[model samples]
Target chain A: MDLDFTPGEDTFRAEARAWLAAHVPATALPSLETAEGFAAHRDWERELSGARWSVVSWPEEYGGRGASILRWLVFEEEYYAANAPGRVSQNGINLLAPTLFEHGTDEQRARILPAMASGATIWAQAWSEPEAGSDLASLRSTATRADGGWLLNGQKTWSSRAAFADRAFGLFRSDPAADRPHRGLTYLMFALDAPGVTVRPIGRLDGKPAFAELFLDDVFVPDEDIIGAPGQGWRVAMSTAGNERGLTLRSPGRFLAAADRLTALWRERADPHDTALRDRVADAVIGARAYRLFTFTNASRLAEGGDIGAESSLNKVFWSELDIRLHETALDLLGSDGELADGDDGGGWAEGYVFSLAGPIYAGTNEIQRDIIAERLLGLPKGRR
Target chain B: MRFLLDAEQTAFVRTLDQLLAAADTPAVVRAWSAGDHGPGRALWERLAGTGVFALAVPEEYDGLGPLPVELAAAFVELGRHAVPGPLAETIAVCALLRGLGDRGPAKEWLPRIASGEVLVTLAPAGSYALDADAADAVFHVVADGLALATGHGPVRASLDPARRLARPTGGEPLMSGPAVRDAVREAADWASFATAAQSLGTGLALVEQTVAYVKQRTQFGTAIGGFQAVKHQLANALLGLEFARPLLYGAAVALAGGSPGAGRDIAAAKVACGEAAYAAARTALQLHGAIGYTAEYDLSLWIGKATALRTAWGTPAECRARVLAG
Candidate 1:
């Protein structure tokens, strides 16, 4: 396969890079801590949307530039190179938008797509129950039939962005008479401000509440809130999960920016005499490059409307592991300062390192990705369950 | 720029795969391993006649023109077959000579290299210090000036029996100055890429052989491949190959395109391929049971080639150090 971008795509990249340089402010970049940081990150997302630069591969009607995947990749590369803030609406832009496009009704699309495109509303996923981390099908969240709608009751832990999100989409057991647990599932969406819903921030080891625990007791979801059908929650959930597993979570531009920062950091701080550390930095740079190529390949395929299948699992694992390793290399280079916290006496390597530990845990654990590769890609037999 | 292979390159890859498949089967590898150098001279002659060596050489240099990525893709198939010989080295030498703009030796040597009449190996391993007694010629690049060892005495050195390693005995100076340093570094980079490509092939072959053996060999009335431990090990070997393949291809492309990032890419590819090939070979040997330990089996030969190639251009640690230094 070829790795070179086309001339047209290169021009697009240059244009995108120029725009980012002109418009993306230095102060808008996000730190891993602080609500203000996330707010600035969201503001940048809106800025990108306003420039018609966000979601470059989305259809023109959906506020995208209707660019080719190669162009989209170029845009992403330039965006990351610009060190733009993380997209605050990434969960919606990456996961829910695709789902809505595929499964949402006309009115639903009319209402949600624009808001998502403009970054007017933030979305979060309420998927994992406390008892059903990897075993997602065992989710005990229940939804009962009610007057012209449904009443929901469940607790979703690790609900990333739940505390700040305007809305959440998740699966609920909707049919009490269904024999199979999966058969009773239904996909539902609700405002986070629904009367019976409560969001509790969960402070991670990194001392950031990037995730929350959502408790739902008789939360009302209108009939229109059901994405597909009464018994279609599993399918809808799978669609979202597939998107999450594949393209939505990954951003090549983002990692490239990190790689650039990492390279500059190493060049400035690392002693060339410490050959081992130098080598590790070299590896990190290479990994970042490879990761970008891999993502770009998949992006092109997606643009061509081709299915990525189990390969995205492999990509997810590669990038997550690479990000963790790159940050670890940074920490190693920092030596004593690596242990300092964000507000501590030293620099923020300690905080970055702590946050990096989540790379393998969030999205989906690397272990789970391996299992997917083995079972789905390699045709290996499923584990005991 | 596109990341997918263009039509011509795809066709080139298909042709290379077909040629390797027909000519470099496991049986052929077994026979070659049974013989010296792990490749028949006639087979080498056939490949040379196909202009494989001239791929990276400039057309004016009596070469097929530059196609580093094409050469890389072809090597992947060669790696798949575990074909043993110095295909990578010859191509690398052609590229190196081309980079040096010294077509005289290339014009003299490339046709012979293409015809499988002569074999050349680069001596970058002991670049810092040259032994003047063993090599027919020495190409040296340093900050002060470049020098060639001439009219030196013979010397002994330990080398992999499968491939020859010689010290400088004597030769006239080819080229010297700061300009040659770029060429020298480019040559080193090409050599690293070649080693990485060959190691990838060796590792892939090891995985294939190991997987096949595990599937056929049975324990407790069940095939060992059916065992989770066996499956996991085979999977791990496959993982190593997977992780290395893209990096190798990326480096090849970078070098082929003559990108500013070539050095870092080559270093990364060398480290990844070296580690992957070594680990895969070890696991493959371990999974082959007792037969893997025996010379009768080709696994040992593949293992030797992998080990030799891993350390041939540069050690993994050295490559990694160079990459980080950038």
Candidate 2:
């Protein structure tokens, strides 16, 4: 397999590098937890959209360069390596946008995508509930048919970015008459500011309102907002879940950049006595590099027209675990200073370590991921209920 | 650019899988452990006929291709089947001969090796010579260069009985120039890369075997594979094995590409494969219960092999140091 980028890809990388060097904010953008920080992140997304850097992989008609997956990966490498602000529009751009492209009608795409791309309408995933987590099919959220639209009633917890998002997308039980557990589920999108909708921010371990509980009481969601046919939400949401596991949601560039930073940190504090720590540090780098190479293989396969299936579960299990280990190693390197929350004194390590904890829990817990890997990837017998 | 194997490479792997599948690898391994190298030797001849041994030899030397990536590919299958021989050492020796360019010694051994006329194994400077008694030629690896040793001292028993190691008794210095230094380094890297691939293959075998076993082996009137704990353990083992695979393949790519990070990548692959295979061995044995520990059981072969190969080329500590140095 060829590892070197082609001339076109290299040129794209050069262009991306040049643009990021000139435009990326020298200082970190404000955190997306607070109101001010959330607005600042949205503004950053707008700036990226203005420069057409927000969605390089999207089609030109959708305000992107229509770059290949390889170019998108290159863009990501440059983006993360530059330590630019995290994408505040990721829930819209990565998770929902793809579903919209695959399942939405032409009219829906024309009306929704440009706004989502421009960061005018931030999106949050309303998937998991307090009752329905790893077993998403057991969700109690319901949507009853109305005159022209549907009346939605649901409580979606752990909705990331819902605290400040403009809209929410998820599955609703649309046909109560269906006998099967997963039957009659329909994917729907609704504005968070719609009447009878409420978003209550949930404080995270880092004391940030990064996620929220979305409560919907007869929220009117138009028929046009339903992604794909009713009673087929499970199939549609599975695609979004795959995106959550694969490159779109968790790009290898993020881990690689963190690895580079970890190596740099090790170089500064290189001590021969801590052989255990050194080996662990090396392992962390190895895990990150392995992930980068693994993604390249996946991207190459996709380029060759291969479908990504349960293998995404393996990726999710690996990277989520590695992210936690990488951050934990950084904290170990910082010693007592790792607990500090101050901006200085390497407190970012503490913040990162805490955030890494959510990796396994979100996008499907590692436990659920393991089950998928076992049952689907390994072709094992179904686990007894 | 493609990072996964192309069509030809995929076909090559499939061919090797077919051959190994029909070879009764466990019986060959058992016979080799009993010092009956006949079956193992026959398998080696078949592998050579497939040009597995010649994949890394120079094209001019009657070889199909001359890339460490090919060697890595073949060795993964060899490891999967627990192919008994110094297959990795033979390929690495071929790489060393190629690295020596068109020198007289390389020309003398290159064609023979490519045609499977001679069997070569390596002893890296301070380590014992592997397959010393059976080897047609043994390369005495020094810090600076290599010497052709014709004799070997007392054979030492290996944890994995299929492999026999001994001290080199006599050495005839074959190469020692500056170019030879680079060749020696290339040889070391090949050894590490090949060994890593083997570990990956072995881990995969163990995971597959264990998954099959857990599906049938039941407890409390339910298959153990249905148990969440068993499922998670096997999944974790598979995760380790799967993740290590990219590192092994990437190491091949880096070495073939001659990237500046080749050494570090190879070392990283070595550590990752070594650890992953060892973890798989642990999981396999634990999940298999007492049956896995039995000598008569086939799982014992892979278990012993994984334990031995994990530290064969270099210990995890040494590989980590090489990685950290880069």
Candidate 3:
């Protein structure tokens, strides 16, 4: 089997490399969880969209280059190699955009995608509630029939991006009396600043407002904002979950970049006799490379028209674990200085370490992902969820 | 870029699997372990007819390839079946001979190896080759000083009875130069790569068997596989194997492409697949409880091989150290 990139892909890589080298900011932006950083990152998104670099795999009408997955991979490697800013619009562009393309109407795509791409309207996910987490189907959020659409009423905790986002999308109980918990639900989008809506920021482990509790009371949403048919919310949302767990949400480029930095960090300041830590660093590098190759294999499979299923759980578990190991190794190499929340000595690692902690918890917890792998991918007996 | 076996290779695998499946592999393994080489040797020749051994020899040696990808696929099936003999050693010896450019030995053994007429084993970086008595030729591997063993030592016991280890007591100098060093390194990489593939296959087989066993073997009035505890363990095993797979294929690709980093990549795969297979075996034995522990049970065959594979070509620590150095 051939594993080398094609000439066209190589050319795409060159062009992306050139653009990123020229445009990437000289210094890192403040944490995206903070308001000032949020605005700054949104501006970065605009800059990327201006050049159609924000969503390379999307159609041109949606401010993308319509690049193939392999080319997108090339662009990702270039983007991370250039140390580009984290995508502030990841939720919309990576998560919501895919679903919009798959299940949303053409009108919805035209109305929502361009804005999402340009960061004119940042989107949050409002799926989990206080009671529903691994068991997401048990969410209590409800949508009642309104004069022209639906009025949402419920609390969505740990809603990513909701603290400062302009709009949000999630599942709501459209037919509460349905026989099954997953049935008769509706996926809808609504303005976050609507009359009866409220967003209460919640500080993450690193003390940043990365997530929020979204409270919707009579939050009116237009009929056009609904995605797919009423009872199809579970199916539609599950599709997005796959995207979140798979390559789009956590591309190998980020880990590759982190790996490179870890290697450089080891070379720069690590003790010569710390063979154990050195091995750890090497392992992180190997793990990152393995994930990168595995992703390209998946991209090839997808390009060849293969369907994605529970296999994303494998990707989710691996990268989430890799993220933690990488940051931890970098921290260990920095010794006590690594513990600093911020500074040039070991700056960004503490934040990275804290962020990696969320990997196993979000986009479905690792526990849940493992269960999926066993029952679905491994063809294990149907286990009690 | 395609990261999968092409149509011809896929068909090759299908044919090999059918031949292997129809053969009573367990009986052959048992017979070989009992020092009856008749069935195992016959099976080997049939496998050679499918060009399994030919993949190791150079094209000029009346063989098809040094095709790493196809070799990786073929060896995985062999491991899945838990075939007995010095398989990886034989392939590594071919690589060694090809590198030797020793006209006498190359002409004498390469064609024979490709035809499955003789089994040549190499003990490079090690003191002994498994099944040395059964092998037609055994080479004592030394950097810049390669030699053919004049005679074999008494058979030594191992943790697994199936692995019959013996050292070479005397040697006939075959080659002595710097090319031998390079050849030794390349052959070691091939051995590691093939062993890694074997470990991956054995682990996969163990996991698949465990899953089937758990599905039917009930506890608490329900199938044990339905338990989350069992499911989670099996899931972790699957994850280890699944992720290890890409590394194996990537290592194969690197070897085939002649990448300078091929040694380091193969070492990484050796660590991953070896550990994955070892972990799968542990989980299988634990999950199967008493049945897995019994030698009479077929599970012991794979379980024993999985354990040996962890330290066969290189231990995890050594592999990880290589990774660090790289």
When superposed on Cα atoms, how far off is each prediction in RMSD?
4.1, 1.5, 1.3
Give candidate 2 misplaced runs (Cα > 4 Å): B142-145
Write one digit per residue (lDDT tens) for candidate 2, span A295-342.
988998899899789999999989989999999888888777777865
Model 3 CA deviation exceeding 4 Å by range: none
* TM-score of candidate 3 on Cα atoms, chains taken together: 0.98
Instruction: Give chain A TM for each model in order.
Output: 0.92, 0.98, 0.98
Question: How good is model 2 by TM-score?
Answer: 0.97
Better of 1 and 2 by lDDT: 2
* Candidate 1 local lDDT, residue A57: 78
lDDT per residue for candidate 2 within B184-243, as digits (tens), equals 778878888889989888888999899999999989998899888888888999899889
On DockQ, the leading prediction is 2
Task: Give lDDT per model, in order.
Answer: 0.71, 0.87, 0.89
TM per candidate comes to 0.87, 0.97, 0.98
Q: Score the docking of each candidate (DockQ).
A: 0.36, 0.80, 0.76
Docking model 3 quality class:
medium
Model 2 chain B: which ten-residue window has the lowest total lDDT? B64-73
Tens digit of lDDT per residue, candidate 1, span B1-326? 45555678778767766777787455555554344433455565666666667676666656676776777766766666666555555665666576665656667766665556665544553342222321233444334334454443333332223443444434445676665666677777787887788788788878777766876787787766666666666566666667677777787677776688888788788888878888888888788878998866667777777777788777888787767554
